[model samples]
Target: MEKFTKISGIAAPMPMINIDTDMIIPKQFLKTIKRSGLGVNLFDEMRYDGDGNEIPDFVLNKPAYRDAEILIAGDNFGCGSSREHAPWAIKDFGIRCVIAPSFADIFYNNCFKNGILPIALPQEQVDILMNEAQKGANARIEVDLEAQTVTTSEGEVISFEVDAFKKHCLLEGLDDIGLTMEKVQAINAFEAGVGATRPWV
Candidate 1:
């Protein structure tokens, strides 16, 4: 996982609520376990038509938001199934941060694990971000993980809360595998001692 410290970039506004995993990557795109290629398929159903052509009206397909690195979505974002692929697609698409009024517990946890910052804020704060996102590439939003603050293009500051452990993990680029590696020396020592004391067993 890549470290997420601070990011200032374009934010795409998706006001629809209840954006589930299926809508994000679709069942058809789940065959591959790899996370790299999923960005093209992110929001596949919404981005393509029946014939597989890009929809002009989709926020991601629009020229201004094609490179959006942040998302400002409506309430109840990431509801339904606990698929890790959802965050993978979002991250692969270059979205480092997501701001919403609320998020599903499993999805919120998955974001941090995948190096994506999922921010939950009050409705008023989210509304402010959503409005800023509507400006597309012209307005950039800044998310400072260390400070736990989001500054809009107009310099409006909003504070958000994140768990200390999760913040540390993201800042240090430590995923489950990375965390385990931190204890390698201790694990090796324990194994050596066990072999010396209980070789017969």
Candidate 2:
């Protein structure tokens, strides 16, 4: 997992609610468990046409938003099935932060586990970010995870709330595996003691 202390980059706006996992990366793409290379297939259905051509109108396909690293989404974002792939695809696409009016509980937690910051804010705040994202290449957004604030293109500062524990994990790049590794020495010592004491068993 990568540390997400501060992120400043392009933000793509997707104002659709109830964006489920299937729409993010179809089930066909789920065959591989790897997280890399999922970016090309992120929002596969929306990005491609029937013939597999890029959809010109989609925000991600547009030249300006092609490299967007943040997403300003609508209400009820990340709804439906609890698929970890959704966060994988978003992260693989270089998006580290997502701001929305609301998000599904499972998906929100998944984001934190995958090194993606899922921010839930009031509708007004999200609306402000959405407007900033509309500027495309010219506009950039800044997310200060430590400060818990988002700076829009117009120099507007919007504050958000996040769990302190989750913030600590992201700042230190500590996922479940990373967290476990932190106690490796202690774990090893404990195992050694257990083996010696219970050798007969």
Query: Candidate 1 at residue 150, lDDT?
Result: 98
Cα TM-score per model: 0.98, 0.97
Model 1 lDDT per residue over 1-201, tens place: 799999999999999888888888888877888978899999999999999999999999999999999999988888888888899999999999989989999999999989999999999999899999999888999999999999999999999999999999999999999999999999999999999999986
lDDT of model 2, residue 171:
96
Q: Over the stretch 41-127, how does candidate 2's per-residue lDDT look in tens digits?
A: 999999999999999999999999999999999888888888899999999998999999999999999999999999999998888
Identify the runs in model 2 with alpha carbons over 4 angstroms from their true place.
Answer: none
What TM-score does model 1 achieve against the real structure? 0.98
Judged by whole-model lDDT over C-alpha atoms, candidate 1 comes out at 0.93
